[model samples]
Target: MRKLILFDLDGTLVDIFDEHINSFIRMEKEVFGVDIAPEDMIKNIGHPARVVIAGPLLERGIDPKVIEKRMETAYQSYKKQLGKALKRIGEDVVLPGVFRLLEVLSQRGEILGLITGNISTVGMLILERTGLVKYFKVHSFGDVAAKRSQMIERAVELAEEKYGFTIKKEDVFIVGDSIPDIRGGKEFGCKTIAVATGLTKGSDLEKEKPDFLFSSLENTEEVLKAFGDQI
Candidate 1:
């Protein structure tokens, strides 16, 4: 049996909450001429960015093609701005205990993978900048499709194909910071571990019925104690 752990990047691994919110606001205003409220935008934080943009465009009767073009332009602007912002903020720091936990897991021969809503480019940039890129052996990006479940499904498939091992639904864990992460993981019958490091609070995540919940990556010891033996 192979034990695989899939992590969500933005909130679970790196703290980019405010940077993302502001970046989206800037892009939305530049391309759509509409200022999105942070609260409203926060609601869609953990899903694919393209799907998030397209949903509202459809509601407003905009053609998907046009919306896609505008989104590309907006994303370009966001990339430039985000690059500058990252320099000022320095490389993102890992949440407490993350390094230690990942080190232990890697040494134990557990498969570590990434399934994030961020596009491949942006996700890679963040991981490279944070020096955490080495931890992930497989990744599924949001740019592949807007649906979260679809992204995870692809990641799982890639894992199976690349590693030459079968992964049971229960043997896979999706660790992330929002309800969508929990929902998507469950949709595929994988275990869900919710963390309260992003927009959603622990209490709110609890109501969503994830298999597990934690305040932050600092709970690494607890996580290992809970799941390490299974691996």
Candidate 2:
């Protein structure tokens, strides 16, 4: 099997969840003069920042025209704030075993890709600065799709085009720390691995019943085994 592993950036391989939320708040306050409640963001991290905003705003009866007009402005503000935040935060957010795991997988000829709520531009910048970009062959960012599954579908298409080979959905492993990530993967019939290294608790992730659940990605050998270390 030609394994294609898709990693979620924010919570799975990096620790910028708080910075991400703070940046959104900063962007909203700067552009719209309204501070969105944190609860709205916290519950929807694995989604596009715009979708996250529009969903909550619509539910609360905000006008569609108002949202449409602000999306571009809001995204630009988000990009600016995120750039500032990442500089202050540094790459220390890269989690334990991430470097080694990626290194090993890359060496084994497994195709690596990123699927995250982050816009492609911001996502690439984060990967480049943190030294993880080289491992990935393709990516599908929040800009590509509002829903996580749709993002994965786009990423799969990109991966196939870039690599010139089709990957079986079952052989495509989706790794993340949130229920949304797991559910998103399940929608595509891909094996999901839940890592408790993010905002979600280990027990909580366990309840979601990912195909493989780990307390953290600190155990390199165990993680390698979960995805079939044919090497």
Candidate 3:
């Protein structure tokens, strides 16, 4: 069966952990004059950029209302800095087997969509740079959605509208490398595939009990099987 496979960009498809953390640190410290720790950022990975940013600020005793007020401005600066960061990092961030997996999946006629915590521009930049943008027909972004659940909803809505076909929830697969991704997929009534290629520990991902779990997507054939590919 052709599945509606929704992918999380940052950790699942690419290892942007370093650039992401550094950019967040610069945004919070330089723009907000507040030091944000890398660990705090890691704890909140896979969340919307706002939430990922807010967690550390909130922990630093910054008032929630204040953070909310500056978020629009802060995120704007963040996107710019992150763009520069990615440009510097180049396409090396694309993870192992990502191209081959996406290639085979696209060739197989399965629908692919991006459901990421990254804002549209930033997310598209990464995809464009890595040449993976062509494979995805649907784009669900973080700045547009307050939560992963909302992103998932947008992906489904856009997919159906773009392709003119109703997508069953069970046929939708949420692929990511964090707890929120798995939890949100389950809550949204979709199959979840957990990959430990992100900052999340494999044991923690196991606790969430995704429909399928893999250490990484390096084994193209094996990972394909999880997506129900006969090969």
Number of the predicted model whose TM-score against the real structure is largest:
3
lDDT of 3 by residue, 165-214 (tens): 89999889999999999998998999999999988899999999999999
lDDT of 2 by residue, 21-96 (tens): 8888787678667767888778767777667656766766778898889888878888898898778755577998
Runs of candidate 3 exceeding 4 Å displacement: none
Q: Best to worst by TM-score, what's the order? A: 3, 2, 1
- What is the per-residue lDDT of model 1 for residues 1-231, given as tens digits with 9 covering 90 to 100? 668899998888888778777877777777877767777677678889786555555665777788877877866776766676666553436676677778888888888999888778778888888878889999999888677788888988999999988888878888988888999988888888888987788999999899888888775568875564622
Q: What clash pairs does model 2 have?
A: none
Clashing pairs in 3: none
Report lDDT (CA) for all predictions: 0.80, 0.84, 0.88
* Native-referenced Cα lDDT, model 2: 0.84
Q: Give model 2's clash tally.
A: 0
Of candidate 2, the 10-residue stretch with the lowest lDDT total is 51-60
Mind sharing the TM-score for model 2? 0.94
Show how many residue pairs clash in every candidate, following the order shown.
0, 0, 0
Q: Is candidate 1 or candidate 3 better by TM-score?
A: 3
